[model samples]
Target chain A: MRNAANLRVQVESMLESRIPSALTPKIKPPLESMSCGISDIDRFKAFGRGTLVEICGAPSTGRTTLLHGLLAQCTAGGEAAAVIDTSDTFDPVSASQSGVVLREVLWVRCGVPRNQGRALSRLDQALGAIDLLLQNGGLGLIALDLANVPIRDARQIPLSAWFKFRRAVEDTRTLLVVLAQQPNAGSSSATMLDVSQSSVEIEESDKPSVEKHIDGDCLIRTLRNRAEVLRGQMTKPVRSVRTIGEFSTSLYSYR
Target chain B: MLYAGVHLPNFPAQAALRNDAEARQKPFAVVAGTPPQVRVVALNSHAKKMGLWVGMTKADAETQSSVKIRERLVRLESLAHAALQDCLAGFSPWCEDVAPDLFVLDISGLSNLMGTPVQIAKSIREQARTFSLYIKIGVAHNIDSAIHAARLTKNVLVLPTGGEAEILRDAPLEILEATPEILGILHRWGIRRFGQLAALPELALSERLGQEGLRLQRLTRGISTRILSPTVPSMAFEEEMEFDHSVEDLKSLAFVFHRLLGQLVLRLATRALAAGEIHLTLHLDLAADGVTAKEPFFTRTLKLPVPSVDVTLLLKLLQLDLEAHPPGAPVMKVVLHIEPMRPRVVQNGMFVPQGPEPQRLELTLAKLRRIVGEDRVGSPELMDRHLPVPFRMANFTPSNSPSRKLPAEVSQTAVRIFRPALPTSVEKVRGTPRRVRFSGKSYQVSHASGPWRRSGEWWTRGHWGRDEWDLVLVSGDNKRIVVRAYRDLVTGHWSVEAEYD
Candidate 1:
């Protein structure tokens, strides 16, 4: 009886192995993932294709820095990236230092208005642009940088827009990153990272650093003895809120 | 077979019917001449069935109350002829527009590019279908035989090589397109069909009827000793339409543009060419001293990134441009000129990531430009200078050319400049910024570096000088802000310049 039972078990295992793959449930391989180019944040979460990532933080919290890193990683892999810059705060010189290929990056600057009401209208246009870019697809990364946009104006953005973007990016290898002062996309995003500046440390120099800072619209620039870069750290929300490391990387330091 | 001919039957009636669809399937005749004595130039089959002949006087034709008559439009005849010539240009370089309703092409060596001569004839007929024009094609060893065969056949007729005379024997002498006097003399001689005309002695006909009769005899014998004077293709691919009335709405304008673009694209495709640029000139009906005048023109030229023949893409681009820069008055006439060029062949790199389609990319860029101001969208190109944020917006044309490898010593740090640098109040400790106040908020400068001085353009009155500093500031909440601030040396004012990403 024991020998007969062993034969039955062997026959069952052989049948299972012989079954065509089409007859069984497919085990999908893991999704293609990429790092945000920041070691501290990469450990907790990595961006994946066809996913929405939100980087929310107040002004001067390294939101722009995180955006640069994402763009850099995308372009460094020979992929193209774009920034729908609401409030017109994208600085190419600073972005290039974060390892972004400027040639591969498309910078679309939404008009910056001085009044609050006009600023809200500008936000609407920016959202439309986001939808346009998402529908167009083929982009490795599309960053909607609204960090400088008023929080109230950013809030006026309909939640349905986020869901629309989520649907547009599904089954595609494009990453949609929304950078804002606070979380605006709600639950539609696949990954939500809250960035904050924890501390500020200014490097000391004997002579004041004054490199040429061209302000064409204002036309005020001058040269100084030395250049300074400010570095800082944010440590909290170990799981959700990610802080930026390598704060010492300054504008002059990259060049 | 070396030559082919296209025959458009009842051309006048058909041309009129093209613009008046309701008149189709009706007994109609196109008449031209003085009113009472106006004679029918062409009549449709239904009209012919109604006993309306081409020479019938208008008054007599009107006696048949059911027959409809439309004045022959000379302009339409010319346009249709040009259109036919453009279409036939694709088959062979030697195309002769012999009449308003006739075309002959020299297809001597097109067997390799287009199959056999019969296939070429069929292809010509098929391409003409796009215009809803029905044409009969004939191919033969000589032009005269080809012309005769085209008129006699219902569709495509290919005469056997060296058998033109035998095949053309039954055709009517009118197929030769001979003069009325010669035709009258031939009729008096009882030579109605080509066989009777060809049976006459050539020397006798030449002696009696002169050159005209000799040519007729040669045509009847299916012989063409004359050289083919092919019309040279026009350099400019252009179409013009003058509206019956001024069009004030975009929809009507777009509709007209759609038709024009279709015809232009067909012309370009026939020659294996693409449009490099579209120069659209709209004649406006603007009021001069409150009087409607018609000379004002609004011209806009759209340059294509790559030569393209895609009608939809071209139309969209044109519509976008028109939307952005609308004419000041109603449009009375529109002319479209296409610059023709060979399309560029692009070979994508093996490792480079795929980008959006070039046509799509250009269209998307145009849309973005409309949404934002024109100067706000484009790839960033750094200006060659030490000036901060020294760059300008330019036309965006994506390059597939390989990017140059970066130097080992180039800096990796990039700075994002804030436009209209935020004006700030600074408390300087011995000419060094120690505190900053901007947007009703103040920050203590934890660390400050700079006083870098750069000034130039002394030759002009607009000279600039500034003291710059890169600072790490601590807000009241102890939130950190890294910024680059500058003080105007001449104005004695301070402003926040840019932030390091």
Candidate 2:
């Protein structure tokens, strides 16, 4: 009985040596989405990768405020972003002031049209530029600034183009943000934020024009206003551009 | 232990025959010197069979038989010999170039890896054949014996160890390179065969011929062993192709390019390397009418974003670049040279977001550059100045390090600049621009601040002085817009410089 037990043990050990140990394959975790860093905005929604976000509003509606917020968030997070400016309207001075790492952002300026006659071709050029940027993946966010281009010309951008952009960002962790005069990406956008100014306060400047005024005049009214932020689909009626005074126009500086 | 010798009798002719398939079939010899004094410097196997030899007058050879003579390129012979040495290095690292036509390789331990002596010889012969070289290989116990066996044998001869003396016994003494005086004395003594030399009394021979004769006897006995001082082998990863006719179509040219790139990539892979930069040289076929015919050489370098051996990616990049900058004339010849580098080994962090392949990003950037002007594309870099729009374009190279998390404490207003500031007409009230007309629209100033003055570069051209204002304007529809308008103090012109978002 002892000999049989020894033989059995030997056979078991040999079998164990012959069979390789099984290893568990590593499962990768999901990547985190980039946030705009605004308490009200980031809390409500974060700009996920492979998604399109649109921000459009009338002039002084804080459309640029949101755009800069996203740029600062991306650059400060140590990620690179590109802005395809259709009207050549990117200010580096203000971008740096907003905590944006200018080194991380690729700014491409498509020359602005001098008149309405050149607007159509200029828009086409901008679209072509955006297409190139979209294909060059590795960016955290690609903001298409078409706010200065006429809304009619921007609307002329076919749905197929938007669909192509949607497909390009599908598998990659890049957020495509379109800043236009109005909602243009339509249903192709995953999140839409419509900004519109509700009121304007005219504050007379305390500095006298008599000091060193050019054109021999003084004290132009200073602009002060609040804008409403409507988040969701543009087709919905529940979202309105009514100011709850949550937004401020005061100078926010960080050294 | 064993050694081997690879000897090509007429190296110059063989080197010339390389890559010329049609010429190899006919009897040919390479002639040197000018005109009447020209003599045959090297001959091929067919010419040898026709009783032609090197140093024969070129005129005499041409008259004696139907033979074609080509100018002997001394420079080409040197380069080809060096290339042959590099090719042989693939088999064994130890190779000594005893002569321009002959090389001895240390093949002692290669039998297990490459096969028997005959198999190894055949493999080396095959490699030489790629360069259109016909060679004889001899394997023996020592380098000198291997050289003698290779020079005398038709193809391959393997002299077993301890049999070198016996094998060399029948070989003639003329094959030995001895001094003329020693040779005359040996001839007078009738010591012709190596066996006779080996049988000579060592003390007598040494006393008569001194150290020279004693060394010769030792060589005849095959007892000498010396290390092979191999040249430092350089990597050659370049290939050239000349089309039968000029290739006007890009597709045809691309097809040829694809094949050449594949060949080069394979060569790099053999050496465990990757191409850092692929330089392409195109020889264009100029039109008959010499209308501003620029020198027909057009060259471009495709610098890989990252060193890679992947053929598909490289081909795609080349295709895109060529499409952007097409050749001015039809291409007759294309030569590709690769700067080789070791492939980078990257270990990605587990938590890092996977970015696009560097090669892919590079290709895309190139395409963007083509679409937009070169100056218009790339990352934005802030220039050192307080001037409005102090920035320039720089190359876009994204870092692969871990993403930085900015503290929430820092926040500031962001500003976007207008490339060419918009021209505007302003209505000044109390020395402030209270109303503005821009883009065919009027904005009633709701509130405004600043007449901040700035000026610079007064001594240089493009001197500038400007007064800036931050304004909030309300249109007739009650829509409000914030803008910064600057007045050029020199020209007294007001323009919208930028918009705040």
Candidate 3:
């Protein structure tokens, strides 16, 4: 009887080991991963809409020129754009020369105060106008031409204000572009396009000294935390500068 | 009653004064100084009849006219035009600056307030006379006729019905403002005067000049059918209320903000728009204090997701933000401006219902955004392919992102997960499995996988290069664990990086 009981126990242990007990299927949780892309523009393009692209630079650094180029591209793509001219610096003749369709661009002039006494009030009014355009949205490129805005005053824009603006831009496909003399306020996520005039030469005829003409070369640096790793400082020489009518046109070695 | 056109004859006395402020008596003519390559910008009317025409070079003008010449300054002309515009503001509120020193005024329904149009014109001319500028006035049924009559006849030109063609018949083609190319084409067709062009068949004109020619033909016929639509004034998203009592406290001011936000939201929703940014203005009630009313203080705009008309949400967000950064002083009246409301397109899903529910998501996100801020909320958006550490990442508002298509031919390699992996030190061995020590606990390796290596972005500022290994080990508890190990390319030290659950 003892030999028979031991045999039964041995048989049960072998069967349990060989047959394998029933196991529950592991419920796989949904994977949370971000969609990846190559470049900032590519990442934005994947979102499938025109975004706010800000081109900011110091004085006489081809800020307007770059803006005109972008505007032309947008128009060619059958997209509309608006310019909030806080400094009354938008020249239509130059815009047309840069290939922007004048009819397609909505130019809002934020008139400055003629009186020196009301300068602060005028500045506030201009900012209000800029705020209006940004909130309206639906623009392929809404450029705030703060290139002519005083850097000291523009710096007065609080950092929190920039964060709010960045938050406003978040998911919407609109590319928010701010054109300023310097990087004043924007989220760390903002793509900063910095432009600087490399060399400038002023030429005037000996007889007609009243006519002051200028020739200059500009260097544009597109810096972002998320751009391709380029070796050294990417530099391009701009050549051939001439003023046609009211606009100054230049040709660069690289596009 | 006001005429739309004006002309100024070149006064020889004024020309003499311009040539030499010292020489008081010599007769002179104001002539355009055109460079050799460029056309003459402008010329005095007196210089025109002296056989010196516009577009003539300075040398040519000197040879053609016997009268002593003084160059007309384009800058001075523009300045004078601006002065005239300012002066005309007394006559009409609406004025348009036309090119080459012309001003178009809409004197409609202002006859009683500013007297008759004729009286207004006389007042404007008188103002110009005070500035020592010569002037002419033309009154007509419409602007085109008035301008034409002022140019064609040196008097106010009135046109009734189809009198436009008759008046323009004898006028020169230059008055039509047609481009030189169109003029050359018209000259080829033997059409010189405005009357000749106006007399052509519309179909023929359309064929010759295309649409532009057709427009000119219509303009010349005194059709004057186009209405002068005034420019629409800029629209603002401002809501303001006068306080029954000029209370000046922070708490009361916050209440005013609540009420203003409520009104602003209603207006925004009615227009199907969402406010992306908002500005707060606090007006001080200093009228009783015998001081000039100061301008309202402007707050740096606060941006929001989706257009929200909710007073409570706005109040909560504003209160928190404002408390963190409050206004400088007490305010009497508060104004809220929710500007730049984007047109809200409510997309009703085909299979799902649409209502206030989805908006609730935006409100919830906004509340969370207000607390933790905009940066910490959303998924990391990959902006560039530079350093992995400093790669661009942005927080996006939660919304239906368009689905991303995964690229084909992806590697089927299993990805390692990092959970509670403790750093482990292992003694050197061959390229295969070996016993490892982790957290003062020893484990025996049963299975192993992986030699997956990744290199960092060395072309940029920061770079990393490491070789990773995945090893499965059995513990004394009879439980199995997978540990990932990597050797620092620089230091040549191996460390446990992660573990599989």
Candidate 4:
């Protein structure tokens, strides 16, 4: 290790006038990450503070579950958070089951019918709400849920809008997470997670675990899913030791 | 103890000037009582020059060419009285509400902080000008002497202590505000000044006018020993303005709101209070239309998250709300009322986490409500019922002290609910095998859960019963999904309720 350090110094000194320490790699400060309060995801990757994150997946792929986990951790730690539901799909019981303090969350539901012709359309209104939340800078977390929106409509959102949101939250402690079926924030997202259902091998004799006498109604089964980090902080992805994360859900919603 | 008195002359005319610039230049006369006996109770100098005396009838005052005759509004006078007391309270706390337009304060021990008596009186006069009132101030050794001195002085007068009687010797008898009967007798006896009234034989005055006559005689002689009656600060905080030309646009109306909110905020700050709620009323100009509209006023009330005296924030919230629900017609008058509250005091700990600021969050919610609908922004509260999707929206108020109990390491997965459940076709084979189809997609039931029965609201007109099912469906290509499905017992309709994540 000592010989390698000496060689790097000698090479940088020889190329000082030409490239100004061209052999030395530029080091960046480590990004601070807030725990999602779930070992399944935290073991692999955690969303960074003062940065934009995106969670995209197919239906029933644990997209909302991950967002709820992040919110629960934020609220339980004595901070406030907000969710702008573009499709009016936020379930209060499910969020409560996820351990989120309901009082600490500001839920803004976009229930207006789609007025495509108007300048301030449904998507624009949602974006405007997010902008307002960003301008008021004390919230710990803000999630924008656009999962149920059609991809065709979501693509109409300009790249400049994402850049604007990224700039707004760049240096602040607010962590903005966007939920959708596809990564709509383009390159502006500091971290993007692609999710899908993780297949579990089950033998015919090995039936799924079910609660027999407790709930007295529906049978419960454990559902599993996986997430892969598509992009993240630290110019190179070498700092991340784990690449994929696996998590599960309850079949009958004990929540 | 040195006492000070501040009195508003011609209070009825002054109260009528609710920021009306024309009332100061033009002749103004305020009348009271019913139709036959309505007489001018107060008149400005310009009105006095136009042959409009205090005893003239409203009709006679109208006959004078440029006289502006207005009815006496008790509300305006009360508000003016409140403003007068607020101004005096800044100089000293022990102020007495003597009359609608008169107040006296005990300025005995303010020498070190407020300099001499003359300087304190000068400071009070400046405060009255900020309140849009023309007042006369007086300082004397006794309450009655102070009151009479205010009535006699041009602007301000401070009499030396221990010589109150000599200083007020030349003041007229009317300055005492005595009973009319005693005044008539004093006039018949050829006494028009305080010096003359003091010289009358004390025994002869008591025998003729009884106990009341002696009280008046002593009051004029500046020998009053009455204690000061403390005044309580009023809770009402409101400002009203009437425009000569009706305002039709929101942008123009915001300027008016800014002006009014500044005054209200300043008043609250003077009292060390904050506004907890705001009530606004816009008197519409519906008289211009040919049709008769019974309700011509548009009103809106906003309850703030916390008590705040921030003028910009209050104005922004008002502007946003007015933009959402505008008045149907042009507004002729606007009244803004505030509910006062003690300002919140918070001692923040160093280890405490940061949250959304109450004032800015409230402002953000108002802007969001304007963009979305009013009912779309708030915290969600689960209803206490067994029915499907039971919940209500409430205003979000984050507690300062968060729950100390932390969540477990492993999180419970949440489900995404479809607001209106989608209808689907399910083919059941002996209640075991099934094929579900929805939104032009087909799925085979790889595994199925039992049918959970749930029902509620049986006694009301809206009754519901459903059999819920949890199913793990697999497509032809092996893509899998888990969803909650329910069958309505009344309509026999099957729908996909929510997708488990």
Candidate 5:
């Protein structure tokens, strides 16, 4: 070890002009990461501030569940979060069951009566609300829920508006997550994910079935979505192997 | 006790133009009477120079194109007077409301906090200027002397002990507000100035003017003494403005609201307070045909989730409110009243993660409320009920989110609820649902669980009974999905309630 140290010092002295501190390793500050309350998804990379993420899935595909989990993670840690629900379909009961601090979340429900025409107005209002919230720049998380919004209605939103949202939240502490049925943010989103029920091979006991596991009865049990996440884009440099992320965890503790 | 008296000169005229900086620069007269009987009750210095005097008919005043005429607003005069007392009360606690235009404060102990007598008097004059009152301040060793000295001075007069009598000698005796009979007797006695009244023999004056004579003598001499009748400071924060022309556009009202809210904020801030709630009353001008509502005032109340002193934010809130529920008619006058509260004092922890700033968040929330309906934007609070999806929206405040100790890592499950549970057609055999159709798709229930019975509120009109089940449905393409389905026993209807991912 002494001889190696001497050799290293001699090599550093020889390479001093070409490379300063050749023997020392440069330290980089660790990226500030936020958890979406899912271990499989969080392991890939540290998702830091100043990024837009999109969670797209079909109905009953754990999209709302994952959004609530992100909200729960954000609010339980004393950070304020907001949800711009374009369809006014947020369930506070399920969110509370998921450990989301309701008081910490600002819910802007842009739902209009069905009798009231102009489905396009709801989308516009939601987008305008997101812009306002972004311009003020303080919330830790802002989730725009377009899950119930029809594809035709959601597509009416101009691409430039999405880019504006991306630009507004850039380099800020806000983690803007857009929840839609399909990819609407396109290239503006930093992290893109597609979720569906996992096709995990069932055991012999429940052959050819998705094998339902019922904890205690709804008599006194909670409902949670255990969706399999297929990551589309990530913030880190590496691609996820198989992309089997725990996008939404199941909280079957109590009803 | 050393007393300081503040007297507002031409108060009615000043009050009529207090809110209008432009009108204050011109000749203005406030006339009060019945119709053609209307006469000039008060006139500004400019109006006085233009030959406008008290009791001059409105027609006579209108003859002078240079003089602006306004109907006397007793309300404004009272507001100005209260504002003056509020200003003086800030300098000293013991303030006596001697008259509408006159007030005296016992400034004996204020030197420690406000400095010397001269400084207090100058500060009083400056503070009163914000309320748009032209004031004359008098600081003397006695209350009556201070009152008389205040009446005699153009601005501030600090009279030493025994010096008020000499300074007030040249002042008009009309400041006493004597009766006409006494005025006639004083006129007959050739006593036009206080010096003549003070020089009269006390015994002889009592013989001619009765007991009122001796009292007048001491007051004229500026040697009078009396207890300061201090009034209880009323906690009221109100500001109002009347426009020359009825304002029809909301944007135009914004200009008026901005100015009024600024004054209210300044007054609240001076008292170390903030407005917890604001009530705006816009007096509307009805159509000449009387088609509009008889109640001409359109009222709106804005309750802040967090009391704030940010004038811009308050103005934005008012603007948003006015835009949302506009007074259909033109607004002729605006009255703003606020419920004062101590501004929130929060010492954020250095390690705590940042939340949206309280004030900016409010502004953003207000803007969001404008886009969304008023009742639609807020925090969702779950209500305790037997019904499915029970919750109400609550105003969001930064402090509402509390810090909690979290485990090293937490992963929780969530369910997506169908706001209006999707209606479904059930294919049942022997009281068992074998298939379901919803959203234009038919699904085969390959695996199903027992019905979980939920029933409550049996005594109320909204009583409900439902049997819920977890169904694992397989689509045509072999795509599997899990959903919670329910059947309302009361209606015997089946619906897909929520989905577990």
Candidate 6:
């Protein structure tokens, strides 16, 4: 009978050992994926619907011309565009002559107060108008023209403020462009397009008298510096300037 | 009471079946979408016998064994949970799915009835093998130790009373659930392994790593103070409708978008939640070009605002934007996403009359933009520059606020014209005339003004050099036209740059 009980005990033990535990538990974590890389802008030609680009330069530079070309390209491609005129400098006739579709372009004029007693007050009002527009979102390109706004004042803008602006633009499809007269010292996130005038040359003359009629050409230089390529070829000090018109001078010189 | 915990790597049951059918006839491997990919999803002993390794790519495995492949029907996780519950039902009334391949079995009362902790673990392993599933067992004083030992050490780890710290000290940092950023920080600090972290002073760790450091310290010591809270029911509400046929054009896509928006709005209205953002996804048929047996290309996720549930408004916006800016090609399918619904509440004023909220203005503008097109609306902003005539303008989006203060010096030096003088018609004379006719009027050049010459930006391609003259012209009708004329230094032609409006 004892031997029989031993065999039963062995069978019971085998069965008891088969039971699973309830103390331990398993948990799975979520998986993360990799992001794709950015290719050349030209590769995204048809995909430039909401792209924003900025052109910056010193006095007598070609900032406006570049903007005109971009607008003309968009219009030529049958795409509509809007221009916010803070300095009241957009010449619609000239834009039309440059192959821009007049019907496709919307021009908004933000007037600088003519009767502002002080220049500083006028600047403040102008900037305030721009500030108001930026607080509202949803534009393919929002270009803030600071060409007329002096470089000193542009630099006076705190770095922290630019950082805030960058953050606001983060992850949004909209492109925020800032045009400046000079390189406004700040972080590398802001794309800087620098325009500079090279030289003036007289190439032709219509009249041969003492008061000689002259034809002149102006040279313009464009430099595009972005954050990703800042460390490499950007250090090259070479500047490219293209001559616009050549002048044939009789006898004329500036003091 | 005897309890057993079974872990069948990832998709082990299906993997076993696939292997058994092939009978070492083909090389096979399982792929789990995990990093390093070394952690085996599953491997059949037969395939292993053919020198095939787990985590090998499908292509590589086929090249090796030329085996007939069978994909798993159910997720590895659900199948393992069901299997574990079935096998351990007698030992514990409760069983929990711990992870993709692990489980927790409550065997507290069964320890006395079972032979010994080691014997119980062995029996469990033996039973699991019958089903072709491999499991690691740990017999510890508590759940934390048991789980740690089961996951970290070997098949069977019996921890002594105070050996928890020693057992876990040599483990890798990956087991700590450390983020990439935190891991980088630890690596820079020369704390490569878990033992180094465990040996650090709590005060120093906290000061350097902040709250995360404190949590890491606790985890390293195997002192998981966190309780396993019961899973809460998901509150997310989503509805999906499958199309009878694959959609390939904008019209069909728009139809789907309309239907989806209606359903989403109805659901949101019932919940009293206002959806601010919506995401639309399209699935395209990919089998059209005979590229594969599957359907052709499909598009997904076209995000838009969710201010109103109006299907017409949504459709109009979508159609307009698409016509103005169409996707690269025809899209096949679409899915709409309405995100983060908040309680719809509007605070009204009792005394003073309330005006429309700013958000309403946005909606109105959005509608106008849809009709007129986005590029047709906005205020003109000056292109920041130190140049004249060639000033660029930007679209006035309300969000481009000036975050920084303008310097006082710059405002003083720059001359800002209120309006760009429209260059009206100019009378061309044989020579540089003292006075010129403009706008059907003549004016005497009072101060035959300046030759303010400006040259072109040649580096940017286009160039222009013009000698400008600010002529104070007075007409016979007594009308004054302060005209600025420039003789193009390049073309030898004269043109009026600006005229006083």
Model 5 chain B is weakest, by summed lDDT over 10 consecutive residues, at B405-414
Docking class of 1: acceptable
Please give the range of 10 consecutive residues that has the lowest summed lDDT in model 2 chain B: B407-416
Off by over 4 Å in 2: A1-32, A75-78, A106-137, A198-246, A249-255, B1-33, B36-141, B145-159, B163-223, B234-273, B277-305, B310-342, B403-411
* Model 6 CA lDDT for position B124: 69
Better of 2 and 5 by TM-score: 5
TM-score of every model versus the real structure: 0.80, 0.74, 0.31, 0.86, 0.85, 0.31
Q: Name the lDDT of candidate 2.
A: 0.73
Tens digits of per-residue lDDT, candidate 5, B1-501, equal: 799989988888878777777887899999999987999999887888887798889998999998888999889988787777777777777888989999999989888988988898998899878766779999999888898788888898998887777888888888876898899889887889989999999998888789989988888777776898789866798889988788787898787787778777777766778999999998888963433546788999998878998888899889877777767788889999999999888887877888787778888887787778779888888888776677888888756345565523344445667767899999875456789999899999765564778888888998988988777778898877767899999999999987765
Once fitted onto the true fold, the runs of candidate 5 whose alpha carbons sit more than 4 angstroms away are A1-29, A113-120, A150-159, A200-243, A246-255, B34-37, B65-67, B109-119, B177-180, B201-214, B242-246, B286-295, B400-412
Across A1-255, the per-residue lDDT of candidate 4 in tens digits comes to: 999999999988998999996886766566667777668788655588788898998877888888888888888987889999988889998888888888889998886742222446667788999999999988889999988888888888999999999999887778899998899998888888888988522222233336333221335467688988887763454443337888876543452
- List pairs with backbone clashes in candidate 5: A221-A254, A221-A255, A222-A254, A222-A255, A249-B413, A251-B413
DockQ values per model: 0.26, 0.23, 0.01, 0.43, 0.37, 0.03
lDDT of 2 at B383: 84
Residue B83, model 5: Cα distance from true site in angstroms: 1.4
Stretches of model 6 off by over 4 angstroms after superposition: A1-255, B1-242, B246-255, B262-316, B327-330, B337-358, B363-374, B386-448, B455-459, B462-464, B471-480
Native-to-model Cα distance after best TM-score fit, residue B467 in candidate 5, in Å: 3.3
Model 4 lDDT per residue over B206-286, tens place: 999898888988987778888998888787898888776787777888877887787678778778889999999999888
Which of 2 and 6 is the better model by TM-score? 2
* lDDT by residue (tens digit), candidate 2, B1-501: 578988886788877666455678889999999878999998887888999988999888888566878787765566457557756777887888888888999887888998999999989888776555678998987888998888878898888888988988988877676888988899899998889999999999989999999988887887776667776656766766666578777777767777677656765664678999999898988872332337688888988768988877787777767776776678888888899999988887886645556777777776665555556667777889655577778877666443365635323444656666889999987677889998799999766667778887777786789988877777888776777788989899999977665
Q: Write the per-residue lDDT of candidate 6 for residues B148-173, one digit (tens) a residue.
A: 56766557766655666778788777
- Residue A200, candidate 1: Cα error in Å is 4.1
Which tens-of-lDDT digit does each residue in A89-178 have in candidate 3? 465533554455554455544553422233434345445544544465545555666765678887887777667656665454344556
* Pairs clashing within candidate 4: none
Better of 4 and 5 by lDDT: 4
Instruction: Give one digit per residue, the lDDT tens place, for model 2 in A88-156.
Output: 777766677666777777777666432213343566767777787777677888988888889888888
